[model samples]
Target: MAGLQRELTLRFLAEPADVNFGGKVHGGAVMKWIDLAGYACAAAWSGKYCITAYAGGIRFVQPIHVGNIVEVSAKVIYTGRSSMHLGVDVKAGDPKESTRSLTTHCVLVMVAVDSNGKPTEIPEWVPTSEIDIEMRDSAIRLMDMRKKIGAEMEAHIHP
Candidate 1:
């Protein structure tokens, strides 16, 4: 299905309300945007309602100022029977300037669900280009790392 339309981008102007006391956009606002973009990508790819199962590795690289042109891009880099893993990037730049710097990045896992809210099978995404392959591989590496971390956490919590 031609990579299954695996990417989605959302762009808008950062509002004054998005800023914190320090006058920069709050981290929580950016996270909300990431979730929104991730949900859109997952739903488009799966053709079903999706819910986030995991969101981690959120890194805030820089602060975003209000009135900046903000862009959040979400791409489905890997998929399983019911889960789509997305890499989301957030960037912002002065409206008068052409350059945009990355402000945040994270990986999210979203699961497609049926009317009963149970996980359901969805279409798979296949990498088609070199960049796509690289992105997919990166997502797989992150997945492996997450599993290791989860095991460690379980051990620490129970033992």
Candidate 2:
């Protein structure tokens, strides 16, 4: 809507407990942050509770070390009747540094839900900037790819 927020940012420090055997932040930890950020953005945009329907194109571009400041940013790029597509980016850097590099990126689809947990209608998201338009188009393209993949998987399973 006119005054609604479409984006969210979460910042936290990577802790020792979040590290994996490789001495870097675990992939699962980053994924959880992505989901949390996406959900917050989706719920804010829809003004309702939301649940994650899909998450895809997860890319780990760099490693996050313990004590690094991690920032997860999420924005709504597109919307269906009950679903919102979120583009999420995770960045990490040393606490004493001034720059953070992108560590992970993903797109997630979250569906607004009612009190009974059924899908509920959500306000449409309109792209107002060039970047917003491009991101929305990208989300649409990914959705199309997912449909084709799902169809192929279904065919193989049935055959």
The clash count for each model shown is 0, 0
**Model-by-model lDDT, in order?**
0.93, 0.94
Per-residue alpha-carbon lDDT of model 1 for 1-159, expressed as tens digits?
Answer: 323678889999999999998999999999999999999999989999999999999999999999999999999999999999999999999989999999999999999999999999998788889998998999899989999999999988999
Candidate 1 has an lDDT of 0.93
- Residue lDDT tens for model 2, 1-159: 521999989999999999999999999999999999998899889989999999999999999999999999999999999999999999999989989999999999999999999999999888999999999999999999999999999988999
Cα error of candidate 2 at position 116, Å? 1.3
For lDDT, the strongest prediction is: 2
TM-score of each: 0.94, 0.96
When summed lDDT is taken over every stretch of 10 residues in candidate 1, the lowest stretch is: 1-10
- Candidate 2 vs. true structure, TM-score: 0.96
**Residue 68 of model 2, lDDT score:** 98
Q: What TM-score quantifies how close candidate 1 is to the native fold?
A: 0.94
